[model samples]
Target: MLLPMSIQAKSYGWGFKKNTNHQPPDVGVYKNILDDLGGYYLDNSGDKVVYLTFDNGYEEGYTGKVLDVLKEKKVPATFFVTGHYVEDQEQLVKRMVNEGHIVGNHSYHHPDFTKLSKAKMKEELESLEEAVAKITDQKEMQYVRPPRGTFNKQSIQWANELGYTHVFWSLAFVDWNTDSQKGWKKAYQQVMDQIHPGAVILLHTVSKDNAEALAYMIDDLRKQGYSFRSLDDLVMKDILPEPIIGF
Candidate 1:
């Protein structure tokens, strides 16, 4: 089913933004750092593959539709859900797990990790992990995305101590405007121009435009010789090579 064109686009409305000297997180906060956050694209010998991930802070009225498209496409994705979204949309959380999508921690309240005290930061990460464990019966939730794409040395170090590989993204569309839908052609072009193997893409389920255009984008990427997979797969084996374009 196609999402109505009349359905307005929506932003994540995380209630915060971060402006730092660091390069915007393409995999996680450490993507701009020398050491890097996690190894997403370490080996580039295979066909171009894209990693699709979503940040779930709250409901924006389009997530369910996005899930439907993903389900139909038989594509797996990773969802970084905040504690709030997880609790608020527990049923959807169950669906994600049941449908074989990876659900990682996006923090309890979606705070900027670098600004929070070390203890508080750790609490944020662990609390969300615990919440998911309670519902999914899974004890491990190792992937993370810092709220607002903000992080620092201490934040990354603390997360590592907690055993999380901070995940950011390399490609994104302007889907955060609640007033106007990000045009499908623009969204498709933005991604196609930057298509790379092991690239992590951040598209919010909040945007109806994203949901509507998703299937088409998937088909186009497949034709371009790129396969779609979840981030969980990238962490499990050495299937992707490190990106040569933006690192």
Candidate 2:
């Protein structure tokens, strides 16, 4: 679905048509606003590479396994964590940083930024940053994946003005709901079926299926000649027109 055309406060849940052709899903009309305000959905290159990311709203007891899989696979990823996650699971957040992964801001209260004033948005980000700073070595939060995948031009603009880059996803599935999981094999198949070049994949840490299928996914993807990269690499690519995707 398209985001509201106006520049006012309108909440938009991020979505796109699912593709099974190993290509980036068309983001419809979000291309313009994202391109104009530094939002990234996927890498613009056709190389066989992917960026792994997770949204941690609350712990479902699988992040440790997810981290273990990443450690075993030596794949660097970014975990966008909320305030509750940080406050509740400090060591896990610390482990994310100590293990060479990025800890992105998923906001403090996990509220809709479009409905919030710029100052409230800043407060939300900074509060999470401060909470994370006390527990992890990473002090400044440079990336933001909006709560519930919702945003607008004003929200993106405010984030940019606050020295943050908005990151959307090019590859995702219906894996967030814990009540109706489709099993690990289904999750694996979903990713493998929709896999593509330079895809910014969005997965939830709350998914037991994701944690179970992560290592296998990494191995099989590598077997397909794809290399996993970090969000740092993605951001650098955005800043410089080098060999990065999503230009």
Candidate 3:
């Protein structure tokens, strides 16, 4: 039988023994590895907005279809990709860039930033920064989401010093497990049920269930008066338009 969630976290390196509150990563200060990484913090005050993001650790087997849905919907998004996956899925990454989506680094080995040594973390991030540069002209890949939402004050300081804005999820669904029976159904319900204004929904692109549910999820959210937006559209100060809907 499966162990409890808390126990599972221990086995999977998701516990808070590595964090101040046993919470997901948050920003503070990090060692400097680069000078252009961007970071984000809570900015939307009294507004109902949501930012959708995905971590491409490997592949969800449905990323292509997910991209197609986003492309068809003409909605922009941020795709956090790892170096190994980027190398393996070069064509898809190219398509993402060519199709006008934002691709950020998800580290090379998907290590928990807090668990890695400062130097190792720097290398992990820098390696991908270089690899992305090799594929695209966007030299300033400033955004990073630590693997498994693990971060700490020191790691955040280090990442910030390197110019990266560590992103964490406001909402996430269990779309990573292929063995789950109700993966897509549970994902759909979880996303729709908990969605709030300015939430950042985290989806894994390595799940076929997530892929199958992507378009429907977008449509459902749209029907509920939410519009899909890219992380860039939501955060970047100068690029965003005046607020259309807010609470």
| TM-score top scorer | 2
Per-residue CA lDDT of candidate 1, range 1-247, in tens? 2223232121122211322222222333233442443433222344477778888888888888878988998888888999889889988888888888889888999887766776898899889988888888566787888888765555666678778887766666577676788576766666666666656778887777777778888988888677776665666555445543210
lDDT per residue as tens, model 2, 144-228: 9999889988888889889999988988998889998888999999999999998999999899999999988999998998889
Output the better candidate (2/3) by TM-score. 2
Off by over 4 Å in 3: 1-43, 181-183, 237-247
How much lDDT does each candidate structure score? Answer: 0.70, 0.89, 0.68
Candidate 2 Cα errors over 4 Å, as ranges: 1-5, 240-247
Please report the candidate that would top lDDT against the real structure.
2
TM-scores, each model vs. reference: 0.79, 0.94, 0.77
Model 3 poorest ten-residue lDDT run: 11-20
lDDT of 3 by residue, 69-120 (tens): 8888776778899988889998888888888778887899887776676789
